[model samples]
Target: MAEPHPVLITPEWDAPATVRALCTTRHGGVSTGPWGEFNLALHVEDDSAAVAQNRKSLLKACDGLEQIQWLNQTHSPRCITADGNSLPEADAAETDHAALACAVLTADCLPVLFCDETGSQVAAAHAGWRGLLDGVLVNTVKQFRAEPETLHAWLGPCIRQPRFEVGAEVRVAFVERFVGPSRAEIENCFSAAGEPGKFLCDLATLAALQLRALGLSRVSDCGLCTVDDPRFYSYRQHNPCGRFASLIYRLP
Candidate 1:
């Protein structure tokens, strides 16, 4: 077994054997400034060497670095399958290979890990409000060949509803896409911000709703609030912040 790094572990329905999943906390790398200690994002202003070292550290924590598939996230609803040969430029990655891993990076956006209890497949997604509104979760499950009931999901760390304030336009966008009690559900996800047209939104609950809409009955979330938790790197709290990652893979 690999030694535990100072990170957050999120276990889905399959705990010990079928698969493993985790989201890194900004607690154990060589980054500085707003990026702080454990920034894994390449696009951030942190030194490339530091980012590389952080990645290496993460790989070590996860046991090995053979086939981890990292995506270039754009906050779109695009999801893809990856192998060791090539990388995909999308928000989510799913795979059935034991050696291959699927990963998603985020600061405040929701990072979702999906897998079957039987260890048949696994997927990871980065779902910002934009992606959620545009059907990213729905698209991700659609890409999964596994039956919905057989799938288990885990929501990693993200901005909490209390700290994630948004404008009315953002609420309207989600309202337009969501139906039924979804209006209330969507409204309930938001708390009243001091401003007239603004509200505090809950990314986790929104993601859970999305997963449930996709027929995934088994969903669990870490409930770790990025913006509120100092251990996490939050873009909303710090304007220029680093990104942590949520990764999933079947054991080889």
Candidate 2:
């Protein structure tokens, strides 16, 4: 009601003018306390009515978005085509139809949006550690009919390397999962935290490497850190935090 906080982000990429994308911050919603304002996720124990109202406000703010297909986001590599008629259980979604939005919800996990230079199709992926390790980015690239080189990707805000500390298993996961001449390059994205066996992972850098591995040359990042930025909801900072939305759609 009070100007909706106005924290939406438009990604900088080589996407055509017909492609529309934005990432919402934790402002401009009716939820109270922990959920605070502008929490778009329904699974985070926020009041259903409040979440509904917040979602409605989001729709009003984004022009030319007829419908946004919200996924369950199981942190898997599963991706599907958005039809705007049914809610699916997947981490990524894409659409060629105009005004049908492909959306994903995240608090700390990386949200990656995709589009071809031709502006014919657009996609959004929820790339958490598990999803990223499982190849969600690779699978999302496969969904596009165009060559991977022609597709452009934009990395949204997430937990940065300084705050995202993980166990040794996380480091092993990437090292073991991606073994090659460039494996060391991938390994460089993780560094030992102050604690032994604990490591700080750069999710954005890992995501960029994954995109480059997929032959996508046009990749850009919003460079916003969710944990450090109070404008966003950080699950690591608060267990019962709200979730934000990263969405993309084609304009008619």
Q: Per-residue CA lDDT of candidate 2, range 1-252, in tens?
A: 345544687787778999989999887778898998888888989999999988888888888887889998899999999988888899999889999899999989999999999999999999999999898998999999999999999999899999999999998989889522178877899998999999999988988987887788999998989999998999999989899999999998
Compute each candidate's TM-score over C-alphas: 0.92, 0.96
Q: Write model 1 residue lDDT over 4-97, tens digit each, in one string.
A: 2556555544543758788788887778888878888888778989888888778776754466788889998899887756656789888888
Model 2 misplacement above 4 A: 1-6, 179-181
Clashing pairs in model 1? none
Q: How many backbone clashes does candidate 2 have?
A: 1
lDDT of each: 0.82, 0.89
Model 2 gets an lDDT of 0.89
Clashing pairs in 2: 29-38
